[model samples]
Target: MRKLTIVAIAMMMIVLTACSEGNKNGQGAANDNGKAAAQGQDAKAGEAGSDAKQEPVTLKVLRAGITVTETEFNAYLADAIKEKYPHITLEWVEAPEDVEIEPLITQGTVPDIIIASTTAATSDYERLDLVEDLTPYIEKYGVDLNRLKPVVLDTIKTYSPEGKLSVLPLSLNLPVLFYNKEIFDKFGVSYPKDDQSTWDEVIELGKQVTKQDGGVDFIGFDVNGPRNISTGLDLNILDPATGKSTLTSNPGWLKVFNVLKKSYEVPNYIGADGRYQYANDDDIFFNEQNLGMLAFNLAHLIGPLEELRQQGIELDWDFAPFPNFTENLGTNRSANVHALLVTKTSKHKDEAFQVIANVLSDEVQEKLARTGRIPTIQNEELEKLYGADIPVLQGKKIENIFKTEPRKVIKPHEFESDVRKFVDGAAKRIALEGIDVNTAIREAEDNVNKELQTLQTTR
Candidate 1:
C-alpha cells in the first residue's frame, strides 16, 4: 500500500501477470490511471535484452464479475499498458456470468490476476493459494510503504501475513452516516455532528417520526444486508487491543441489533428491494423528510445524493460517521479493500513482483484517484486529487476503519454457513418462539465455534 517510483512501477508492469484493481467503475479509467503513471515517473519498462527489440509481453487477467468499464475501460487499459511497454500485450479472460471463477484459480487455469469483491469471497482465493503475495515485490521494488495509510494496509494483514502479503487492497469502503436533515430540522433536532450520536438516539428520533403516511410508515435504518449487519457488529464488537471480536456479549451491540430488527415493524426494514433502497439512501433521506438517520458505504450515500440532485429533491441531508465505541474510538469497519499479491507458486517470481510493484506507483495512482479510488500511495498527488477532506463518501474515517483487529483468515464458507443456520434458528426460536436474547446468542456462538473448529481441524 505504498507508492513506487514511475520507473520502478513500469519495470514491475513488465513482469506482473496482473494489476491489482479496486472499485473500478469500468475499464478505460482503470488504464487511464496508467497515463498519469507514465507522467509521474519515467522509468525503464523492464524490457530485458531478449525482449528489447521484440514487443512487450501480453498478460491476461480474470475478474470475478463483469465490470462497468469492461467493454471500453478494459480495452483502454490494455492499450495503455501496451503503449507504455512497446512489447507487452494485454489479454483478458472473461468467464460466463454464472461460472464460479475460483475453481479455475485452484486448478491454476485462472488468468494472471483476479479482481474480486468482499473479504469473504477473496479470502477463499487466498486460502486456496490462488493469488500471489506482493509484499516482497513491494520491498524489492522500493515501494513507499509509508505513503499508504496504515489502516488500509492493516486490513489486508488481518487476513494474511507480511511474509506472504498474498492480497492487496487498492480501495477501501467506509460506512457513512445517513441522516435526513429535513426531518431533523422539522422536529427541531440537530443533525448528528460527525456522526457522534448513538444508535439509541437515532432510534428514538425515528420513533417520533414513525407515524403513518397514508398507511405507509418510516423507521431508522434499512440494513437488510447480512454484510451490513455484520459490519455494524464488526465495529461495535471490535476489541481495540487486538482487534478481536469483543462485541458478541456486549450489551451495546445487543441494543443496536435489537433496534435494527425492530425497524421491520415500521415498514422500513428494506427486505426485498434492498439494492434499490441502498441506491436511493440519499433520496430516502430527502424524500421521507422524516426518517431520522441511517449508515452505509460510499456508493450507498453518494450514488443516491447524485440521484436526488438530478431529480431536484430539495430536502436537507448529509453523511457522517457512526458513533464511536468508547473502547475503540475513531475505529469503524472498512470493507472492499483490494491488494496486489505475488503467487508463491509463480514460475516468474521476479518478473511478477516487479510488475505488481509498478502498478502501485504514483503515476498510476493519480489516474486511479480520478476514478474515485483512494490511492495506496501516500503522496501530495493523492491529496491533490482526492482532497484532504474525507468527502463524506461515508462518515469521514473517524478513528480509522482501517485499523482493525488482526483476524486470521477463517475458512471462507465456515463462519457464514454456520452463522446463517445459527442466526436463523436462534432468531426463529427467539422472535417466533419467544426465547431470550442472551440465550439465543450463546447458542449461536456455540454453533459457530463448533463450525470453526471443524473447518480448522478438518484438513
Candidate 2:
C-alpha cells in the first residue's frame, strides 16, 4: 500500500515539471516576435529621417490684389502644411500697389508662387514666361484632376499652351440673382425661381415692382456694378483671334446691349437723372430694401447680407442662379476666378506643388466653402454643407447657385481690361443716356481699337 501511494506522488511531480517547460517555450516565442517588430519600426523611422534630411526650403509667395495670402490661409491650413513639411517655410510677399510685376520679372526676382485672378492680367504673365506649366507636377503629386469642377478647370487650362494646367483654382465667382423678399411681398409679385427664371422673366417681374408707391421710388432690377451688367450680357468685348473689339463685329453684342437696355427702360426702373434714385446698386439691395432683384456674384452679396442679418437688421433676401440673356440661356457668367500658379523660377518646385495640393485638399476646401468662398472642386458632400456656417443663408434657396455651370470662354481676348471699360461705357450710353445701340457699339469699337493700338505700342 505504501509503494502504491509513493508511485502516484512521483507521477504528479513529473506532470507538473512538463507543464512548466511548455509555458517557458511559449514565452520565448512571444519575446522573439516582439524583438522583430521593434526592429522593423526602427527601420521605418530611419527611412523617414533620411527623407527629412534632404534639404530645408522656404518658398516665396507673391499675390496681386485680394488673392490668397497668410491672412486668408487660416489656422488649419498653416498647421497642416507645417505638419506635412516641417522644413518648408512659406514667405508671403505682396507687390507694392504702384509697382507693376513686370519690374519684378525684369529683375529676375519672380516669386516661387503667384496668386491672382486668372484674367487678362494672368494672360500677360503667361506672355512674359513667368507662369510655369504644371502638368508634370500635377502628375508627380498625383493631383486628382477629376476632383475639380470640369468647366472651370478647362477654362484655366485654356490659359496655357497645349491645354497645360497653368493655375490651381482657389475659388470661382459665378453670377447669381439676389432678390429682396420684402420687395416682392410689397409689390405683390411672385418671387423669381432661382433655378427656372430667365432674364426675360425677371424683366417682366421687374416691370411689376418698378413703380412709385407713396412717392418712394423702387427699382425692380439692377446689377451690382457696371461689370456685373456687362458680364451678364455675355458679350466678349475683345476677340482673341483678331485681337480687335467685338462690340460691333458680333451680332450677339447688339442683343446683349438690348437686354440691359430693356431692363433699364422698365418704367421707373431708373430715375429721371439716370442713376439709381434711392441708393447705389449694392445699397439698394441691403439698406434701402427697395431693390427687388440684384444681379451680382456671390462675393458681393453673401457677406454683406450676412453682416446685416447678424446685426439684427432684417433683410428678407434670397439668391438664385444668375439670369441669362435669351440667346445665352443655360450659361452663367464666371468672372474673377482666383487661382494659384507656380512660377518657373521656383527652386523647390516639388515643395511648392505640395502647398497648392494642400490648398485643394478636403480639409482646406471645406473651410473655404463654409466661409462663403466658393470652392473650385465639385464636392456633393460639400454642396449640402454650403453656407452651413453663414446664418443668413439658413433657409434661403442656395441650391440653384451651383446648379448651372459657367460658360467656358476658352479664348478670352487680350487687352480685356481696356475692352471691359469700353463695353461698360457703351452700356452706360445705351441704358442711361438713351443713345442708340448701333451708334454706341460703333463708337465703342473705334475707341477700343485705338486703345489696343496704344497698348500694342507700349508693349
Candidate 3:
C-alpha cells in the first residue's frame, strides 16, 4: 500500500507538470462565461422539450474517490440513463483517487464526466479550466437547480469561477446533532429540539447529563473537532473579502470556541490523560451507551449504526438540527457534497449533461436517498421518505437531516488549510494543555500569519 501511494504521488507530479504545459497552451484557461453563453444559446435550440436528435455516443466516466463505486453506480444510475438515452453508453472507470486521472487529462484523454468528493474536485485539482462550467448546460437543459437543496448548490458554486456552478452535486452530508435517546431518557432530560436549541442551552443540557450514573460514565456530548464543530459554527476562519486569516478577529469564532471549551471542560468528559473517559467515540456511544449526543453528518446515521448492530450492539438514537449560535440562528451548516463535473475536453458535452440531469431528477434523487445517500433535492416531502430502502433506518428521525439550511462557504485558498491546522492545534492547547482561550487565539493568529508569510516568501 505504501509503495502504491508513493507511485501514485510520483505519477501525479509528472501529470501535473504535463497539465501545467497544457494549461499554458491557452486551452486550459478558456473563459467560463464564454462557455456558459455559448451553451445557453445552444440550450435554447435544444430544450429538453424540443425534438432534438439524440446522438449515439459513449461517455467515459471517472470516479475519483471511494465515495462511490462502479458497482453501486451501475446498480443505481446506469440503467436509468440508458432508459432515457438508449444510444448513449457510459464507460465507467474507477480510480483509487483523483490524481490517477490527471495523467489521462494531461495526455489529452479526458473523461466525459468526473465524480469526486468536493475536496478532491475543488482544491486537489489544480487545473480548474479542465472542468467544464455546467451553468450553460443547466440553463439549456432547463434543469431545475432549485430542486436540489440550496446549501448543496451553494457549496458546488463555491468551487466555480465567477459564481458559475461548474459541478452538480449528487449526494450531500449535512451536519446534525446525533443523540442516544435512551441516554437522554435515562437522565430524565428533555431531548434537544430542532428549532429552539442554541449552543449555550445545549451545553448546559450536556452538563446536566455528564455524570456517572448507576456505574456507567455518561458523557453529555462528544464530537470530533475542531474542523467538524468549526464548520457547524459556520465560522469563517478566513476573511472572505481579503482571503486572509481571521483566527483572532472573528468574534463568531471566539463564541464557537467558547462553546467547545465548555464541552471539553464538562466534569469527567475528558480523562486526565487527554482522552475520552471511554475507549473511543464509537465504543463510548455504541457499546458503553454513555454518550448523550454527538454533532455529526447524516451519513453516520446509516453505516456506523449498522456496523454496531452486526457486532451485537444496538443504540437507540435520534438526531436533531445542529445547534446554532444565538446570533447565527436559522443559518445552516454548509453541505459537504459529492458532486459530478463534466470535463471540458469531452466531445459529448450535451450528452454528458443529459446524464447529469437524469441523475439529479426527482426520481433518481428519491432512489439514492432511500439508500441512505441524502439527496441534494429540496423537496420537504422527500424528507419523509429518506432511508426508506434502508431497513435499519426505517423508524429513525431522518427528518433531522434537513433541519437546517446549508451554510454558504467563502472562497478558499490553499493557505486556508494552514489556518485550519493552526486553529485546530490551538483548540488542543485550550482543552488538553489548559491554555487561556484568548491567549491561544492570539498566539494562533500570530503563528498563522508567520506561516503564511513563510509560504509567500518561499513561493
Query: Candidate 1, after superposition: displacement of residue 59 in Å?
Result: 2.3
Distance from true location, Cα of 95 in model 3, Å: 4.4
lDDT of each: 0.47, 0.67, 0.67
- Model 3 over residues 185-262: C-alpha lDDT tens digits? 888988877563677787788887888878767788764655665665666667756767777777767876787688
Better of 1 and 3 by TM-score: 3
Query: For residues 123-173, what per-residue lDDT tens digits would candidate 2 score against the true structure?
Result: 777887878788877765556666677876776776666657788887887
* CA deviation > 4 Å runs, candidate 2: 1-56, 67-71, 91-111, 213-215, 223-234, 276-281, 334-336
Per candidate, the number of residue pairs that clash is 39, 0, 1
Q: Which model is ahead, 1 or 2, in terms of TM-score? A: 2
RMSD of 2: 19.0
Top TM-score prediction, candidate number: 2
- Model 3 poorest ten-residue lDDT run: 1-10
Against the true structure, what is each candidate's TM-score? Answer: 0.65, 0.79, 0.78
Residue 61 of model 1 has an lDDT of 53
| Tens digit of per-residue lDDT, candidate 1, span 366-401 | 555543345665453453444121232223333322
